[model samples]
Target: MNPAERLLEVGRYEEAERSVRESLAAYPSDAALLALLASILRARHDYPAALAAASAAVAANPRRSAGHVERAESLILLIRSREAVDAATTAVTLDPSWPGGHLVLARALVAARSLPAARDAARQGLSLAPRSVAVLLTVADVERAAGHREAALEAVQAALALDPGNAYGRWLLAMLDAERLRVRKSMRALREVARDRPAAPDIIAMTWPIRGVLSGLRRGLAVGAVAVCFLLAVGHWWWPQVDTFARYVSAVLAAVMIGFAARVLVPAGRLPWRCLRLLPRLMRSASVASLVLVIVAVGALIAFASSGWWVLAVVALGAVPVLWALGLVEMVGAGLDDPGMRPALLGLAGELREWWRTTKRELREAWTADGRRGE
Candidate 1:
């Protein structure tokens, strides 16, 4: 094996970097060496240097997909999603049969929040290489972001089946089940991941209660907020009949409630722009019956407040509990399908199976190589 390849395989990335650098100096126009350097830089998390190395490789050999894929990953790390997508697209266009390009494109599109497109690209990669752990994880992430939690869980389960020690896939399953409020599944997956990567950044930074498991408090809080909004609608409708001050309070409450709902639903901060674009579509992915219930509750509040339909207001508030129940039922139903424990157990089993097979294969190959050399 080449010095860089040997060092990289042994996880001595710094040594690999030095070896690649030395080789690149000797063969300045060697695109493969540049690609190796790009990979080394990426492994070291030196994204800017990785991007430069990858770009050099692409410039040296535009026909190769590896350089473009490396460039796309570096671009993604640099938060240049559009450029990453373009680079990845170029890679796949150059070699449609290569799963690498499709994988990169899928990931870049996911980062760009073009979820449907990301899912499509991921599916394309999977169609090309169904056993690819990378593509499976990408598809899982895409499905999760698209609110297809069951599908996402299934993808992670499949990936774990291929290579059981994939922390990223485990992390994904934990987070997905967590979001869907599957307490036992979330905790099981979360504990397994924490065992492997105790201080994983995402886990450390996670604000989710119970270490990424959805606590009762979180669900109750969301439910309470929605219920309060329905109550506000009632006030806005009936308070005018009571007094001037009461009516004024109702208006302020209604405005505040609206703002709160928007903030909670759309989410804000780092990806506010992208969230704004995706929120409507994501909202539509929610339980249809539950959504209708909430809508009817809100509409009834409006009717009572508008047409002085006091009776309708009572009916709307009465239905709030039922609507809330239905939403919870829908969420729980989704969670039941994504039982985290089963997937985690499968992953563990797969890891053991893979280890056993790999050890036996390596022993067999070594024995054969020795016999050949002796002969």
Candidate 2:
């Protein structure tokens, strides 16, 4: 039993599963092994397997509170709400002192939408084990579902204070902040959680919009730069009449670039050398570039409107490149600010690479088919 418990505690689910299987092989009627296996399966979200294992455990030992609890958890996952409630209730009645029984009952009640009952069970479990973060989280969930946002936030905050490294608690807090439209605060909180769990889908989704915004800004700048340069260079040669307007646009663009570049590059003398040295010069450069591009775009628009020589074409030529530059800047800025985005960006790159490979493969297959048909 100690070995099995130790295996479970260490998250060696395979070893725990094997140990339970071996124990069941030696003692085919062992209800405890079945119950343990059910718990392990539940953790893996193999709810059907857990249900079968829990059912066997209960059949072997109807009096076992753990077996009933395990079955109730599986039933809850399976969406058998009424049956889960009954099983959870039975488990609590069988062993009122067992925290697991109350926890299971709380979960089942929550599933059944019986918020008050769920809260009671969670409170009972918390009383039995005051240090159980799981119980506290369950209570928080009940409070949140019951429209007690402040209470829910407090409960989650308490859990986090008890264990600052609690990823789930931090994530919940971030979600609460996001719901309240605290975009920057929510992002800051999620950024921390994303550091530990880079592959989390929710984190990726939340950061995506910010990433898009930054990318759009960068792309807008680059395109604007190239457009202004081309327009001024070519317009100066062909349409010397508008030379003054072109020079004004170019001057404005240069000033904007220089100002932003200086702002980004020139550190505030107030900061220590160590902090100043750590500033990302490349990001600053990109920010400067974006500002310059925006200024050039505005100047180009003003010139085009005043000169009135195919205004749409002139505006479009400047605007398209600026938009593209803005997008790139946004993508780079997001990656820089949220270091956690590195892995997600890498993953996205990998996905794109795979898609390219697949596309090539299909194209080759189609070409081969066309050649055969021609023959």
What is the lDDT of every predicted structure here?
0.68, 0.69
> Weakest 10 consecutive residues, lDDT, candidate 2?
267-276
lDDT of 1 by residue, 1-375 (tens): 778988887679999998888887789988889988998888877777888999999999999888999999888776678989999999999999998788889989987999989999989999999988988998898888888989998999999999888889878877786576554565566566766776443432233332121223224334543454455555577653343333343334334444444433333123222222232232223344544555565455455445554465455556656655655664554433333323434555888999999999999999999999999
lDDT per residue (tens digit) for residues 1-375 in model 2: 557667887778788788888888998878888988898877766777888899999999999988999899888776677889999999999999988788889888988999898888988998998777887777787778777888889889889888999888988887677555455666667667777876553533354223333344345445554555566666667875564555455456545644543442232222222222233454445544654555555556555545644453355366656556654664576355553344445656888999999999999999999999999
Clashes of each: 1, 22
At residue 35, candidate 1 shows an lDDT of: 86
Candidate 2, residue 220: lDDT: 43
RMSD of 2: 13.0
- Mark the 10 consecutive residues where model 1 has the least summed lDDT: 209-218
Return the number of clashes found in candidate 2: 22
CA lDDT, candidate 1, residue 321: 62
Q: Rate residue 127 of model 2 by lDDT.
A: 96
